[model samples]
Target chain A: MTALIAFDWGTSSLRAARLDERGQVLEERSSTDGILQVPAGGFPAVFERITQGWPLHGATCLASGMVGSRQGWREAPYCPCPAGAAELADHVLWLDDVPGGARVGLVPGLSAREAGVPDVMRGEEVQVFGALQRLDTDHGLFVLPGTHSKWVRVAGGRITGFSTFMTGEVYAALRQHTILARTMAEGAQDNTAFLRGVQHALRAGSLLHGAFSARALSLFGELTEAAGGSYLSGLVIGEELRAQRLQNSALQPVLIGSPALTRRYALALSVLGVQARELGAEATWQGLWSLAQTLDTTA
Target chain B: MTALIAFDWGTSSLRAARLDERGQVLEERSSTDGILQVPAGGFPAVFERITQGWPLHGATCLASGMVGSRQGWREAPYCPCPAGAAELADHVLWLDDVPGGARVGLVPGLSAREAGVPDVMRGEEVQVFGALQRLDTDHGLFVLPGTHSKWVRVAGGRITGFSTFMTGEVYAALRQHTILARTMAEGAQDNTAFLRGVQHALRAGSLLHGAFSARALSLFGELTEAAGGSYLSGLVIGEELRAQRLQNSALQPVLIGSPALTRRYALALSVLGVQARELGAEATWQGLWSLAQTLDTTA
Candidate 1:
């Protein structure tokens, strides 16, 4: 029997899963009805529609990601790091009961500070926890790549700190809005060009200067338009890596996210002579499941 | 009598000046007829309209900037650095004689390469030569700040080499197209916040990480929306400065651009204990006039 219903909801998409008592996925569903697309006062209907046919009785329901943001159905205030499953569980913003007898909870996102500058993440914390459970380690480093890539560190089963790099977003803006677009060609990513860009980014100290290389290389006939996009991708991802100064570090970061992004990050990490392990959707499900375990079943 | 007719024709605006025998501006006219705005085969019409009432009879007319680009009326190939007034004069793409028996020439842009990556600039080359003439220096460092900022080095009255940084363009994209836009306010700049951003950029090692601070700082109420734009401006400008490793360099690069931009650059440079002198449109006219001096009067 399904014991918990978990959601990995974000701005542009919604994902739901039914898990057994052991946090194993029994069934799953998803939709394009993300927070941004939800009409005003429409979250309840959308939620019910996506969770239809799933046995909701006696199964605790928990939701994570921007779904808990201010714009979401219910605002789940952020829990400050270093925090782990217990802290998140303690801070869960309990929602109204559903038609079934199941208790509904919204997982609070995590907030981190470095040198007094604040950083926050909602859905990634769940993945980090799941990664810990998967890796069976109390300490680790993690990177979640997307429009906003997160570099996270955890120790003693709690998140200590993390930083966000707008690498993917910056790449899109440069390619679509800036002069760099002229050199880019559309199609599948060329890994060779991507690696070349990564190597160039690693060797260069300034992204502001290094990014121009794509345009310059194209003008000089040194790099083709077809490879420009991948090269640009490599530069941004590589810049993210360069800033971390990870080349000298002994730590092996665990990359958590979609297969394509993880593979790219893994390839980029290889340049520094570092090997990274790739984790996929299983981490998100596992993370939501781990958070679900912290909820009191007796209640 | 006008000894020369000079045009500073770039991507967005056109400015024409009539200079006397001493290279002094006698009369100036400007319009929105930048090269990009000119219609196909419409440059001659726009040019005729803008130069009306000015005697093109014997004056050698010279146009600089994107007017020499491929899209411009006539493409003047870039002159390789170390180029000076003499090199530009020798390579000028002379156009067909205009009505009234007048000669016309397009000043070629300059090109520089570092580590095999090519860098190109059009109108800024004119400003650089003009700066050299005004400063009366055989060798100096110069910065022309705008959509794309150029860092040029000159020796023996020639631009030895230069680099381009898309600081301004990147700033516009991030402020308008990225999530950071949520924190920005539209209005006059706040110098304090801008300097704060510069200081932060100097302290931080990675721009990819540092840029996020704009959002994070706003989320925590440390920076208000009103100051966000200026702070972002500082960050981009600071990143450019950081890349040049100019913090320790004794070179007080001459600032050549609009008053607003040059003032900001000077302020940013002051943080590193470096003092910079500012030049305005005088540099462009002087540079064009200097190049005109090298032209064959008998021809």
Candidate 2:
């Protein structure tokens, strides 16, 4: 059986998994030297250091995330969406410099434009594609919530387009640094407050007004500090729903992420009169592996 | 000439101005020990250090800002709206230890509740009130643009109510820390790009949507790095105007602040069909002085 390696090189962490030909994980290693942690031109050396004792006599490797960003070793051109596993594999950048005659391939991210809004998704596209492959549906919306939450549109087993909202980052900043920081009680979630905030945003009829209202409401004692984060999340997600509905009324949206993240999206969607499904987290790794399989076959 | 001392003890800066009975400047001193900089119970020492050699034996002293906050020397209770100079002066807190020394007074901020919305203004209350005293207007909106922009509604020479928007702080954070930091050129106004962004925000109808649109617009060449700051300024100011208009129908707003800050607010207000006038920078100091005058006469 042929052994393959897949790496997700993010901003702060490097996660690599070794898989057999059928994609069963054989070994996995994680390191702290993400792209931001390494010096220029140190990626090759770092990769070698991590995989020192791995059985790489003739292994093929696939990589994603900041490893393919502009600052990465080689600029991997982004594939325009409606992209699938085949398209991602076709655009992979093959590196032949690894020891033991191993070949490394970097998967390209996806970008798209809709209604004059340009969007780019890296690392998550493969997982989204993998989730879709398992969904048995031809068309749906995919929600990938994180520091920058992305709402993706998929049709015919391909990513048609997507939009991004800075929900996660905004929550972090407001909760950790702003005046709201003091008010929020630690490790508490108030669903009622969140739902109230979501409904309030919908009634406000404008996201801008609603965003400021979050601060006002908190100050006015209409919202508790512990629930301020949830309120903000609801407000952003509600605004996204308002904008997305204005763009496409027929597309059904699916959420792909951790349970908590997807639950928030699902809650927001339900409040907006839409149904959503939560895809598994493993979908991303599976999608990356599937792309690796395609790259191996094409090569 | 009888000396009057005015102190604006805000969160980040402590500014004290010595003036004659007629409000002519005598001498001024500033200290780095703002409310945030000083430890609890350190306010008295910090104040004494900054005002050394200034004749405080019988001068009527007025103070505003965080000096009235809970963390300040003592909690000066908030005065309800429809409050005048005499009302603010009457609510002032006198330091018990300095009873026979300086005729010390802390100006009471204005607070109001209407339609379940509670709004409060502290230091800027005196500034806007003083500006109104200068304008001799019985009714109008006063916009104080700063780290926390305040929109105060005055009727019959009393501060009826006000709304606070954290526009300046948000702008600083986004420009200095976020991904947009790379897109924003340092220091200088791009009027054209700012105008376009304000117009876009006005049309977008929501702050959250408008904020995310900045990223997309940058990608689409609708905005540039040098103009990113201006664009962001436009979006925030535009959204503020949109929210303000929803609560009040009058389109004319008086602006109180430095010339540059007011100009930006005026430009954004212009997009929303509001005529804005700069009430001048000296208004804050003058307003604090006005409160001092009232306290002196009453004492």
What TM-score fits each model? 0.95, 0.81
lDDT string for model 1 (B1-299, tens) is: 79999999988899999999999999999999988899988888888889998898766899999999888988998898888777878889988846656677888888888776688889898888888888888888899887788889888888899888888888888999999998888868899999988887776666777788998888778999888999999999888888778876788889998899999999998997888889986799998988887775433
Question: Model 1 segments beyond 4 Å from truth?
Answer: A97-99, A296-299, B296-299
Per-chain TM-score (chain B), model 2: 0.91
Residue-wise C-alpha lDDT for candidate 2, range B217-237, written one tens digit per residue: 675577777788888888777
Candidate 2 chain B worst ten-residue window by lDDT = B242-251
Considering the two chains of model 1, state its CAPRI-style docking category: medium
- Whole-model alpha-carbon lDDT for candidate 2: 0.74
Give every collision pair in model 1.
Answer: none
The sequence of per-residue lDDT tens digits that candidate 1 reaches over residues A136-163 is 9989899999988899999999999899
Q: Residue A294, candidate 1: how far off, in angstroms?
A: 3.3
What TM-score would you give candidate 1 relative to the actual structure? Answer: 0.95
Name the lDDT value of residue B168 in candidate 1.
87
